[model samples]
Target: MLVKHFPGETIGIIGSSMASALLAQEAGRLGYRVASLVLQEQNPVRQFCNWQTICPVYDETALRHFAGRVDVVVAETGLLSHQDYKILAAITDLTLSDDLMAITTDRLIEKVFLDSQRCLVTPFSMVTSLKDIKEAVEYIGFPCVLKTTQRHLPQSSDHVILYSEEDYERAERKVEESTCILEAWIPTEKKASLTLVRNERGEMLLYPVFEVIGSGELHLKQVRYPANISSMVEAEMRRVAQVIGQALDLIGSLTLEFFITSAGVVYINEASVGLSSEAIFTLGSMSMSHFEATCRALVGLPLPDLLPRGRAAIALPLVDLNYDEVMTQYMMRTDWHFAFFNPRGHSVEDMQGYVIVIGDSIKHCERQIELSRLTHHPK
Candidate 1:
């Protein structure tokens, strides 16, 4: 059963990332009291929350106390499992759709579910041993990616890309060899994602699709809004996303990532729940912040149509590696929008900030990105 709450009621949030902070901020802006369970010693989310419980998520005494005070809970799923959400629902109202969250959070299960729906996911084989990897390589071929089936893995432990058979011997030292998935690496021309919110009543609203322009060597160079894609491709992407939404009977925000092959076939890459860091990519381009749209759904309000606000927008992710370069450009160009995190993490790969620029054309936006010292490889 689904739960509903009024605008003035308290909404509890889990996790301490920027995504969680933005959700809390939007909830507060809409007159809802925010409460959260904090994981980090310092996080921007605490300032937004009316009340906060600073403890491990599964801490019974603290979790129960947090749940007791809130009218509804909306967890950012990366750090919490479906079982944790189930426990939260038992204690109080949890807004996420259990079935959708359960499947989407696990890559292996999500791939299986997508296949079951006849969605075009990459060719993959589930493997538990090196022998399975060799067999999958025989069909999927070299340059495939080997991913652990583990949920909530650290950024560094997530996946290993193999270019040859020698890499398989190297993968044993890197990846968690328990249960994994071997997927063929698609030759992509563009990578894009569409975010949508569906309510229990079956109403849905779609956000502007964005293209990720990355360096082939595993780094996100830039992101552009209203992606450079054909109208036919866009329609197909929307159809696939909505189909998954209806199949799951989802009642919250969902983001579906797609890979466009060199021949222009769009393959479903993955899905995520809640407002992820990727939302920042199209920050100034949307009619309203994604936060507001998602909040309206969370509180059982009617959904609104989200249109592109500007001609185009491009966002460059700032990490310690590129912080100096972005800051130099920031001083010279007063047009770019920046969102920085106050409580920084230990990992350098964690996004430290963003430099977003909205312009009259994608060419204009691309110029800004190029000037920021970020290379945009349109793959």
Candidate 2:
């Protein structure tokens, strides 16, 4: 059963990442008291939250006590174990359900669930041993990616791309160490995602689709709102997202990432519950940001009317830049919005901060991104 929270009620947040901080800020704006459970006393989220509890999520007694003090709990890290889920469910309402977590946490299970819904997905095969690697390669062909099936694996590089037989031999060794899944690498023309919020009543609200532009290494480079896609394609993507959300009985926000091939075929890449990193780009573009929508859904509030401001692009730095330096340089440009997560020692690869540029047109946004890239990361 779903739980409801009213204004003035406390919202407990799990994890201490930028998403948690953003959620706390939005919840506070809506008159909801926010408390965060953090693993460290120096967590950045602590500054935005009303109360901070320093305790590991797996510590049942501590988690139960934390839950008792809040009306609902939202997890941002997506690192909760089954035991952790059990403890949270027993004490407080979770933004994501345990059953949904079980399915989405594992890449294989998530793919299977999408397939069961008759949703188109990338060609994939599950590999449990070295022998399965050859079979997977034979079916998926070369230039495929082998990803670990381990739920919540903390390793930064969980997937390896294989382009040749020699690469396959190396991938086979890597796969043998753990269960893996082989997926054919689609020559994607564009990568887009639809972020939606769903309530227990089956009501749904859709945000404008955004194109995910990535660097050569697959790190997010920029996100462009109102994806460069046709109306028909956008409608189909929204329909698929709605179907998946309704199928899971999603209680809060859900994001469905899709790969659009050159032929215009859309294939499901993955789905995530709660907040996603790319959603930050929606801050100034949408009437209701993803964080606000998630908070509203969690507290049983009606969805707000989503209206777009203008063409917007979110640029993520590929190299670390001094926050003050970047801000000082762009301070005169009112069209640019800056947000630094304050992950002090983290590299650009960690997605620490982003710049949002709103323009009169998409071409203008692209020009801004190119100019900023050249200025910040010159060749």
Candidate whose TM-score is highest: 2
Screening candidate 2 with a backbone cut-off below 3 angstroms (N, C-alpha, C), the clashing residue pairs are none
User: Model 1 over residues 38-137: C-alpha lDDT tens digits?
Assistant: 8666786876788777885456666677788888877775666556666777888776666666774577888988899999999999887777888889
For 309-371, candidate 2 gives per-residue lDDT tens digits of: 765665555244445446664667765666555543556444355667777777887676556
The lDDT, on a scale of 0 to 1, for candidate 1 is 0.75
User: For candidate 2, what is the lDDT?
Assistant: 0.76
lDDT of 2 at 197: 88
Pairs clashing in candidate 1?
189-379, 190-379
